[model samples]
Target: MALRRITQETFDAAVRENVDEFEMDPDEALREAVEQFQSQGVDLSCIVKAVPAATSDDKHQEQTHEILQALESLSVAQDSPDSTKAAADIKCFTEQCLLGFAQRYLAAQKGAYPVILSYCQKSMGEREATFAALSALSALTDGQPDLLDADGKRFLLDALEQHQDDSSVTRAAISAVRHACLKHEQNRQDLVKAGALPLLTSAVKRHSGCAEVVKEASAALRIMTFDDDVRVTFGHAHEHAKMIVLQHNGLKVLIDSAKAHNDNITVLSELCATLSRLAVRNEFCQDICDLGGLKLMMTLLAGSYESAELVRQVLSAIRAVAGNDDVKDAVVKAGGVQLIVIAMNRHMIISAVCEQGCACLSVLALRKPNNCKVIMEEGGALAAVQAMKSHPGVVNVQKQACMLLRNLVSHQPNYSQPILEMGVEALILQALRAHRDCGDAAKAALRDLGCQVELRELWTGKRGGITN
Candidate 1:
């Protein structure tokens, strides 16, 4: 075959045609064009000059310069005779520029966060400017609280307090604070020390109509609970983070937000996960049950079969609420055991779902003897046994499975024959052999089934009283 000599114009034309006609992404089109030329034995190295890609620091500097120019123009525009028109123009321009910086968090990392936060602090009195600045701050400071100094933190808290009536500003402020404290312990502590809990909770109530505000406020409260000090203070030693939120009627807002945005998977997932975390504390279990948390969790579980993450969250929440006697009864009455089994069977491949499912069942079984009956009637014991067999690699699931089985056999001796018939003893013995960490529980479970001889033989010559 004769060689086809490809010129620069030809290559450019091919790229353009591929991008326009085939609707291919520009980068992909370029790559394909280059490959086509190379396959024809065309030398690309000599024709294609490679320009160095801009470093994150360099891009950040360029963005900073652009933002500074916009800010300067905005300052000058505010003083013009046509101040209203100029201010609007400046606000529009500044918002776009700030949004660009915020979207590229790497750009903010190179010392642009303080500059953006300064704009937020300075523009607090101007609604439009304040909204743009706060929005930018929210995006830029996410998980990077060190970007904001003490003054910036205080300003953010104040913004949440001072703009309670301004829905846009309040939402932005709450989101910004949420981002700031999401993973930063010091920032959470700072907010707590500054007494931000009441301000945030108040935002939830004051802006109940604004779903965005409620969502952001709930998110901020959720992130704040990650801090040990804040958790203890807000939840106390016995109470949960939800109790503090309940005091501010934040639970109603969260529930209402989930109801209103039922189709919004992200919103619902976050709300469910937050509720799960709060439900884990013993003090708030009944409160959550009284507030209809169990029904909500069951509903989520029923509808969330396609999303393992949502299923896991719902199961985890149920597990937490299962700690309460009334809640355990409520869960069984609400067909929660069936839902747990469904979650386990559907997402059995996912270790987290299995762990949470087994853990929830274990909690229910240990607390309520009647729950053992419901579990066996619902085939929950078989599900637990199956989970142990399927996820032998998941030590936590194995341990939880062992616990659930032990609960079933110990609490209701009448169910022992049924459980043993499920071949749970073999699964436990396998777990004992597979995961040494699971040996104690597994051995105990075998003993609970009146298999002391096997347990003795299994542990005869092994270190820690178990054979390998």
Candidate 2:
């Protein structure tokens, strides 16, 4: 059964009661509160679960926290005449924000979002102040998506459009957009409605040499292609991706940027992810090939053999574009299959890299008998077997490895004898028994590899229905 959930305020009240009324120590009171709520089958994962240190004087009792105090000071400085003091105060708050997202979360719960937003609104004309406030706002809203309420979204888009001439401000504002729309679907649509797509792409072009700007803009573009919202019944992921690619020359822009920053692993990783997201159409896949994306990915794959994250992203990009048949031919012609096997060999212990590598090989082998010969000759079968054994508990690794096994023999059943010699039968059987999500994949793999499966019967002229 699911545990019942209580709000943060309720838990805080209970803790406070135990401390102030019962006169218990703060630590003991917090533990007692947690025990009391959890005894009633309550979920406490979302609760902060920490006590704020207290100080008292004759005039005041239980004063505000460090974050709350800093917010109050920044609030007062917003009206002060001394620009230097105001900058210093805001700077202090920005330093506080740099501590971590927990401090930022506590600040937002204490109403810091609106205060800092108002500061941003008032600091527009002053370049230094505007940059500082935007930085603080971006930090404050990092993981606190609730603070984006309509006004916060408007300000982020406005900041993007208003501050294009300044790379620092543009980077900061793009950072805020990347954070604001991360899991918030409405914020994504609203910003795109107000013209954020072109501005983001243009920023990448205007500041291609600025690694920080390119990185942030690339991340923002990728975040815009997410379908991660749980609040809405439907998301605009496909629509947003199409708008970015078809209307904004996203393929050209992203590929060109990737070319410029080939040596920068961070930027290259982000561009690889963005390229994967843009492969939503058949022609889009062909476009990626036509724009030299396939060759670029091949180069990155061979060059970044030691970078686990970059190699994983590169494999994913290859998988995405291989949805096109011609592109698959091109990848195989470019020795993509053998490079994938080498990547799996290099990062065999890393499950993510191995999983993507196997999945990419599976795509390359689909419906192409010649590719299967290359996979077998290049030890792709041995690599898949090792990935399954290394990460037995990882369902994705198991499932993709199973599919790769199946694709390797799908069009060429004569190759099954060699794969079976590698002892993949027991592993496939294990996956079939372990994960229900991958049962069909494992079954298809076994069947295509010329293994016997317990066939089910459903047609004996049953009167009303087929067998269940």
Candidate 3:
């Protein structure tokens, strides 16, 4: 008989009798039928509807579970060349079954998180199983917010926590949480509070040379620490906070990672930013200083022209740590003053990084007047002013220049008189030509410089009507 015209009565019997069929032999006839549909390029929704409703018999239930399990496996293997043909065939069959069950299928069955998590932990040697569970979680999380409740959340957390010190399991578990955290803010907060930071820190320390593990651990912490609510949660985890500080080797490891593997800029940049956040706070500045973070940051900033983002982040990390005079003195002593000026225009290569570098330079100037002198001597001030004029095609860079202007004037008020003397008013006024937040920043900086005749004339030449 042609598969297309299978009688509704036969399909109904299949559904009713094989209520547990999915868990059983996986209904080869059903599998073949779906394969035919796939081969013919037909949608299987109608065909899926033809399957009968599941029977209530216990034996049938077992069979149905098996079928579902098989379907899940097939769903995951669809990409494998060896399994593609069979997997595609099974997808069509499972689609029909899933279509028949509809939302009821999803609703009637428990979400696959527990099963998926279990498979991932035990199947480390089996890349396919680990991949399959990872793929399954993507679909399950897509639909079910309440799928994994508090108990389920706790279970995954505890299981992952147990493997916190194990890099492979840590990587997988962190990957799993990356999705879970998005499902609910509370889940993210719970993970942070449950000692994830320390575990991640430990993993970073132990597996310092393992690029992938460090990347994953850093990524997990990024998601957890990104939101303000999660930050507060991190704050409450005082012991973990201390652990992050005491794990003094993390900064050096990250610095070494970036230096040793230039290809992993993305990973290394994230690690730098993550550590900056954790250790940049006032309480942790001393730890950062003791660990030689200032010198490492200066090296990155001075040398990393290829990765503007990493350099910018390293600079920000320095700012976070440099709030202390000793740290700032260390930074100045390490020649950070000379580097910040060159970074302003040259490393302004990326708009975001340029913005961050600009801010970092401003902070450095505020801390060390001699650094401000380096900025001026290197024409860093002029470069900043021109960056404002050329405007880098990114609003953030313009804003950073304007911010740098504000910092320069505020930190070196007397020295900035020469900048005004050199006709920088026109440049600042040019940035203000655009009526936006950046323009506002430019205008505010100029206004703060007070009134000077050269500055007034420069503004007038640019058709900037300044009333002072």
TM-score of each: 0.70, 0.90, 0.63
lDDT of 1 by residue, 1-468 (tens): 555565444666777677779998868888888887888787553232111122245644422233344444555554566646654644554454344433233334345555565566667787877777777667656645567778888888878777789999988888878777765667777777687888887876677666677667777777776754433334231232644555656566566666766666666777777666666556577777777677788888888778888788778778877777878888888998998898899988889999999999998888578889888888888888889888988899999999999888886777778788888877888888889899878877887888753444535565674678
For model 3, what is the alpha-carbon lDDT of residue 404? 70
Cα lDDT tens digits, model 3, 1-468, are 343444333444555444455543446545655565457655444333434333355545533333354555544554456644533434343343333333323322543445444543454454444444444443444334345456545545654555555566556556666656653556665666665566666666667667877787676665554443432333333343344555534455555555555456667677677666666456577666666566666766766756677767776777677676666677767777567667766654456656666676666666466667776776767766666655545677777777677767776788668778766677666556654667666776776566432333334445556899
Residue by residue across 1-468, what tens digits does model 2's lDDT show?
999988666887888899889999989999999999999999886566777544445435664455666777888888988888878877877777767775687677778888888888887777788898889988888887768777777777777778888899999999988988899898888888988999999999998888898889988988888999899889899898899899999999989999999999999999999999989999999999999899999999999889999999999999999999889999989999889999999999999999999999999889889888988899999999999999999999999999999998988999899899899989999988899898889989998888987555658776785787
Q: Comparing candidate 2 with candidate 3, which one achieves the higher TM-score?
A: 2
Decreasing lDDT order of the candidates: 2, 1, 3
Model 1 lDDT, residue 195, Cα: 76
CA-lDDT, candidates in order: 0.72, 0.87, 0.58
RMSD of 3: 12.8
Which candidate has the highest lDDT of all?
Answer: 2
Each model's Cα RMSD: 10.1, 3.3, 12.8
- TM-score, predicted candidate 3 vs. hidden true structure: 0.63
